[model samples]
Target: MKLNKVTLAVGILLATAGGAAQAQAQPVQNIVLVHGAFVGGAGWRPVYDQLTHDGYNVTLVQEPLTSFSQDVAATRRVIEQQNGPVILVGHSYGGAIISEAGNDSKVTGLVYIAAHALDNGETEASNGKKYPNSAHPFIKSGDGYLTIAPEYYHSDFAADLPAAQADFEAHAQMPTNAAVFTANIPHPAWKSKPSWYMVAKADKIISPDLERMYARRARSHMVEIAGASHSVYQSHPDDVAKLIEQAAQNAQP
Candidate 1:
């Protein structure tokens, strides 16, 4: 009788463990997207559309581009609104925002699309200087804010995009506070969370090498899209959405 009882107890324990693993492996249903500097969340429309069409709950955080803390706050607010575990996705400068805001308990994974993934004490400018790209010559600044010169925007920031669409993005630029580039990350969530990164090989804004370095440092699942420009998320939504979905399916809390 005692042997039968022991066997029953072992069966229950095994079943419980299997259940826990199954729960952890289930696809995360909620996704929060953060846009990089020089643009707003609207640029994520393609990606948002794809994810939503697939039945995932998706929200976009429009950072005011006022300051680092403010951007992080904006992202965290959206994260807090999610009903379940979140896959936080960031593009370009948005990467730094998620690196800080992703520490929220609801955030289970991170996705960076040609974005900066800074470490504590490191500013995006400082990090980028280590692997300089061509966009530097096109940067324009005035009254504490910075933007890419409209004439050079297409070539430097979105070469892979349609000329007309790139022109629209150039004129519709959202100038970011200069201080935003220099702001230090006090606690980068990527250090503790599982991450996925996409490297745009033809990117002229942030060097592909820098993206690779960030992905390597985070031990993230990395995907490289050859001939892609800085606006890979906008130009290639399908691939971006695929990686984000992969994270949703595989990332563990």
Candidate 2:
């Protein structure tokens, strides 16, 4: 399996980087998180707290929603700072970013949270060809950017969230370039790394079927969270943290 091959490659890299430490045992505590478009790294606050409390060194990368390449670059910058093995995690469109950035030698594994884990040359929008996102009607575009209208954010995008909180998120969302989805993926990191995915069964932004398809195709260790919204990172931080911790532990050298 490609996942096994690449994951072993991670261990090999670890063995080569610090021979003495590999003999002593290193758990790969480093974790880098990438946020999706429209939301900033602040959305990861709850998840960060959970992971940090568990004693993992977590770094949340604030992606530039300007472009897919820019987002990938931002993620790579964070990965570059890590001294050892890392588990790269992404949410929503951030999945695409990590798909590229996780190719880095330092990355040992990947975790996708209600995200678009597309294959090589695949785009986020392309992942929806068969199972289009149910929340399309809720999305409003402007000047090459996209965002959820305040009216639809509460109902369609985050129905599981408190109405007031959903409304606030909608209002504070950063605009994401509509063109970002058109960018082609060259070498998806998942093809060469162990992957895990969380399916938000109640997500409207990206169909659950599509999420399943991607996870299955990548041979990801998949978990389904019933009634979780697109904002599962905020709504169900504990489960998200558990999945991430599992990835980190399993990826250990």
Candidate 3:
């Protein structure tokens, strides 16, 4: 009888151990990163690596920059693949994408990095008019698309990056359709979801004041990085990664 009791105790212990292991092995939160205009998913390599290294599933959405609907479709595709809740992050014009895409049922949180989180009835172009200084050169229209002036690449868009990095980014920048910027955001997701914002204090392309304004409007948990430029994800990957992690952790179960 004692032998049988001992065997049963061992079985119970093993079962409990297996249960604990399974609980601990639960999947890490998935993150879908959306890049803004003038760039592709490659721009998120640094953050992507960091998140994957830390055990999060990361998907980089390659926005078409062709139209608002296309960008939203691309973002939705990524979000749909996530196994559990997802944190959708957008940088620059990507903010607009997230604002719309965050409405997806899988997206549990949002992180806006120097992005344009415009509310209802706002377009990217209209938001720019509110600021006094157009520190960044006006985009030229060609073939129904928009391209940034090459000169503004180093001084305005990525002033804080090393010269070589800035040059490479300029060369790699993608041209977006003019119609995308003028497209009004009909429904903004931040209206219903929890959000975080990173304000690049030294950003020249988008005014720091505008960043503050957007963050305030979104009622996001805001963090200000004093010397970072518009490309905060590239310049300070660790900081951005930490914020992404926090957003993931705070996501609903």
Candidate 4:
């Protein structure tokens, strides 16, 4: 009888092992990367490649800087195309997009990289008011859009990058309509989901102190990297990729 009991236990163990193996074989997680205003989805290529190489399904959403609703719609479309829960990542203005998009049932986690994570009843303009240092003077509000004057792209936006690269990015900048900046987010996903944050200590456009405030408000796992600018993802893709991976793991069932 003891022998029979032992044999039954062994069979059960085998079955459990097989089940676990099957679960592992399935796609573990999905990641949707959103770029902030002024940049296209192309900016996310490096990070996308790194995440894909590490076995995560990833998508980069190109936001239409024309309006807040437009950006959210673009992101939601990408989320709908994903197969499973997503670790939604947003940078700069993209963070505002994720704040609303992360509310989707499929979004399992959020990672804000030097990005705004505003709560409900908050607008990007309102959040910026608290910060004293406006590093980028090029930002002008007119014609219903907010734009960075090309001259400030290097010193304010991409200070860490080489002059040529910064110039190229400046040329590619897509101005976001002023309405998007002032529009208040109705629902903030971070309130319900797990969140992580990376503060770029040397960020000129967005004050690092404000980043700390946002991280604190979200109760996020915050990591500070010195000597990094607003384009922290471009300057430190590996670190950004690792943070996303950690968020994904934490979101796993």
lDDT of 3 by residue, 217-244 (tens): 8899999998888888898999999999
Summing lDDT over every window of 10 consecutive residues in candidate 2, give the lowest-scoring window: 134-143
Native-vs-model 1 lDDT? Answer: 0.91
Candidate 1's residue-wise lDDT over 1-253, tens digit each? 9999999999999999999988878899999999998898888899999999998999999889999999999888888888889999999999999998999999999999999999978887887788988775646565788888889889999999999999999999998888988888778889999999999999999999999999999999999999999999999999999999999999876
What are the Cα lDDT values of the candidates?
0.91, 0.87, 0.85, 0.87
Positional deviation of residue 43's Cα in model 2 after best superposition, in angstroms = 1.2
Cα RMSDs of all predictions? 1.8, 8.3, 4.6, 2.5
What residue runs in model 4 are displaced by over 4 Å at the alpha carbon? 2-28, 139-142
TM-score, cand. 4 vs. native: 0.90
Q: Model 2 over residues 102-146: C-alpha lDDT tens digits?
A: 889999999999988877667777777778877755364657788
Provide the clash count, candidate 4: 2
Off by over 4 Å in 3: 1-28
Question: TM-score of each candidate?
Answer: 0.93, 0.88, 0.87, 0.90
Q: lDDT: which candidate is best?
A: 1
Off by over 4 Å in 2: 1-25, 138-142
Clashing pairs in 3: none
